[model samples]
Target chain A: MSADAESRWPAVARDYVQAIADTKLLLGQRYGEWMLKGPNLEDDISGASNGQDEIGQVRQLFRLLEKQGVDRDWLETDREPAEYANAQPLDEEAEAWPTFMVQVALSDRAAWLLLDAIRHEDFTGMVQKMGEDEYFHLEHHDARLETLAVDQPEAVEAALERYFPGILAFIGPATYGAGEDPLVEADFTDRAVAEIRGAFREHYVDLFAGTDVTVPALTDDVPDPDEWDEKRRRSGDGHIDQRVADQLQGVTNREYVIE
Target chain B: MSANTAGTGTAGFSIGPEEDADEFEQELWATVDEVPDPHIPVSLVDMAMIYDIEVDAGEVTVTMTYPCMGCPAYDMIQDDVRAVLRTVRGVTDVTIEVTWDPVWSKDMLTDRAREELRDAGIGL
Candidate 1:
């Protein structure tokens, strides 16, 4: 066999990709929930577009994972809540617009950092294509959060205090599995977890300052690794809510395939 | 970039000098250019998704990109590429490779594609 074919691509590689895919899939569903309930007509429209974009990225990763024998269909529609690898905040709907923007600012940045770290890997090509979209998503939320910072400072602060720590878990455990660091060793991502977390802090701190929102201090933002499931790279349990899942699927009507 | 017609199937393609490869490449590009982006109704060529193309005798290879990372039309686009290219003569095999470098953007769209988007009410 050629060197590339003979190479024993590690199962960890596939697991990491699967984790990324699951995260995007769930994140999309969570965003989709806000399509109607967002603060205004424009927020609703933005939510719908961002939700669809995230799901589209999920479809791409699932297709890639399928080459490694993963079933794309099952990954999309059939999985227990705990089985999903998405960060904890996405497990539940955003309690409010500020909460939603908090997830967007931190959770979306986590995804972007992972993509940035993994850009050099052979299999990350599809994920990299998502950078442009992710950038837009971040900017979209940042703007919304900035507006909230001025109009509803109390709401924005409350959400930061509540969700920032859980959002930190979105970075995954600093180390995972028996000294097997797939993030580095498998070329899945170039940076160490600490480095990523640091960058995350720096990015958000600057973002909050620019938006006139108070940036949460990193000291108080630590995630408890003991609660983290390294395999799934998630900090807490529970999948998407079932009722929300039905709404995301829009199962009642499937008359025509979307163009 | 070189093509040798001496063989058939996967082994049919042969590599040679650079100068001799241009005509074959152009022909293959033209053939696959007919494939359209299912969602947009614009040719993949116009969308700049066909990043690279290689032809060796009866075997043809194409590298393509999606409009976005998780574009739902990915499979359909690839199938269209393979289906269209296979219709070209002296091409018994088809290979489609996906790449993400220089990710797709509005700027990548050809003038014709931009015009179509404009007609469709998408802001430039």
Candidate 2:
């Protein structure tokens, strides 16, 4: 409502959009890895279905950004890896399926919370449409997580141990009293984040309750954005490192032509 | 057309097929018809995905195809059909043969199946 809040709205929306896109793209890539490797035929089909759903979710978010005057191609392509705010170095080291699943479960839970907040925020008509699609996507992934936890407890436990610590870092810093960025501060409330985190913790506890695995405690030490920036710069120094990009391309079986 | 007529109905129609054979064929067809497509939740018979159901003595053979070659739900439907047929009485063995010939099309769906698709928001 205030001029300061109005000015910050775009940035906050962009951050939220980036977060959603990152989670979708990451999970989409991960699920695609299980295309023919699922435990059974039914599982193989389920994995592909979930992969399609994640890609669909990404497209929905991209459509929302497009309506906000963001160029579709640039939102998807032109941005440098370092400029990807929600992507972190930790994801690269999640080398196994269980590890990847843990990361997906936690990030998806966070995403559902963030999207729920945005759905209620004052926005244009397009945002509401995209929000409804996102609500269904969240439910789909929630069902998937429950199935994996109940049926594949050991795998879920292993993944949780490998990925839970990075979750706190993934939430990024709290923006209280940090110079007003309307998008970050506008319609943002601590209570919403707390509620979202509470829901996440409940699922987390339920999955890990009877297992030998234990997730590390959430930390107050927020990661510095500059550190992530520097890591990206180092990786992009053109040393012919195509590890992550190559891995993603390999899983999709579609070469990254980048045209 | 009389009650004294042998192997003839009251309407003068001849009962060419044996009663036991006719009853077995009917039972076999019903079992195949009852299997539902797991993803679409419609009876395979209504979808016309089932091409033929043949019963030879104690053996039952079902030939079917999916809406498309790459249909993801194809295997699930096949599994359901197999599971349902295994329960049919007097069926000593059941074999499902998936075929693509006479390829499936929207025309294959029964009128009721088309209405079901429309209700589900999947236009014919």
Candidate 3:
């Protein structure tokens, strides 16, 4: 970052941005791992394309934070698993196709909700461009969701139960509003945490309307702000998957990037 | 300046507005516009990828965006822009800034570009 630009950056800028980028980075990892494992060629292609988009988004987001004094290299490769601000749904690999679908859908929606909120005030133009790419991702998720909910409703429900609470905790308790988050105070996003969470809940109200699955209400317990670590979002020593973190650190082939 | 494929002898593609741009800036456009997009047959300028081009002395700053968010061509496009622009006379430095604002869409395609794409059997 230029010295003048660095001087202009506020102190409370990096956490929210890092949280969104980190979540998308892990979500992208899951997509890449399953790109070829999907049941069909088209599904595999969707996974590959969406996964590539996520990596691109992570780069753009990190570049944004770089202006605020965060080192892109440190943010990408050096952070320990606990230093990551990704949502809990991405803590482990998905063992089943249906489970992966629900997990990805929720995780992607949470990230998008954050992006959509920032689009209103975005000056970098990256946010609006990312929203365009995310539009197709959401479409793909909905179509897969419909089929998965009908074919394996039980698995879908189980996956939803597994992931929804983590997202709630990420958004904080149901009482979240502008007063609770520094993001709102910084004007990085136009919506309060609760409003963003509500927008997320509304996404599933009718997603399974015609399917065998019954969508449940988001009654998950929210994290208490008093004990929360705003930078990491979640309040635990819990870390991301070690295997994934190693891949990021390039314990594998040098050709692979942290994305 | 290298006399490679910087200028493909393509037709006029001077920037639409900003008539006040210096002669060097205008020359920079024609030079950089010659580099074809990796995924498309048309030049970058015709594809509406060149958002802004400003020239101060010999230094040039070009703000551009791509049609797809994840297209790996972004890296190539940056390199190509630099290579082509640097080959231009009086050009000493080149800077490329990628933006996603007003995201690239079919509406941004030039008429000539649309025609070329149509001839290529690529749906817009």
DockQ, in order, for the candidates? 0.22, 0.01, 0.26
When candidate 1 is compared with the true two-chain complex, its DockQ is 0.22
After best superposition, candidate 2 residue B19: deviation in angstroms? 62
Question: Best to worst by TM-score, what's the order?
Answer: 3, 1, 2
lDDT of 2 by residue, A1-259 (tens): 2244233345555666666666666666666766677556865676676666666556556655665566876666545444444434334535655555566557666655555455322232223333434455455555555667667777766676555544544444333223432333555432234344445667667655665545555443333333322222112222212454445335355565552
Prediction 2 global C-alpha lDDT: 0.55
Alpha-carbon runs more than 4 Å astray in model 2: A1-8, A87-90, A120-158, A174-184, A188-191, A222-259, B1-124
TM-score winner = 3
How well does each candidate superpose onto the true structure, as a TM-score?
0.75, 0.51, 0.87
Candidate 3 C-alpha lDDT tens digits along B55-118: 7788888988787777787787898899988888888999887766545666777899999999
The residue-by-residue lDDT of candidate 2 on B27-99, one tens digit each, is 7667777777776756888877776777777787886755543355655677787787888778888787654
lDDT for position A63 in model 3: 70
Error of 3 at B123 (Å): 3.0
Candidate 3 C-alpha lDDT tens digits along A132-159:
6788889999899988887888999888
C-alpha positional error of residue A105 in candidate 3 after TM-score superposition, expressed in Å = 0.5
Give the fraction of native contacts in model 2: 0.00
- CAPRI-wise, candidate 1 is incorrect
| Model 3: lDDT of residue A27 | 83
Where model 1 places Cα greater than 4 Å from the true spot, the runs are: A1-9, A123-128, A174-182, A210-216, A219-222, A244-259, B1-28, B37-42, B53-61, B70-73, B86-95, B102-124
Error of 1 at A19 (Å): 2.7
Superposed by TM-score, candidate 2 places the C-alpha of residue A239 at a distance from the truth, in angstroms, of: 15
Which residue pairs show collisions in model 3?
none
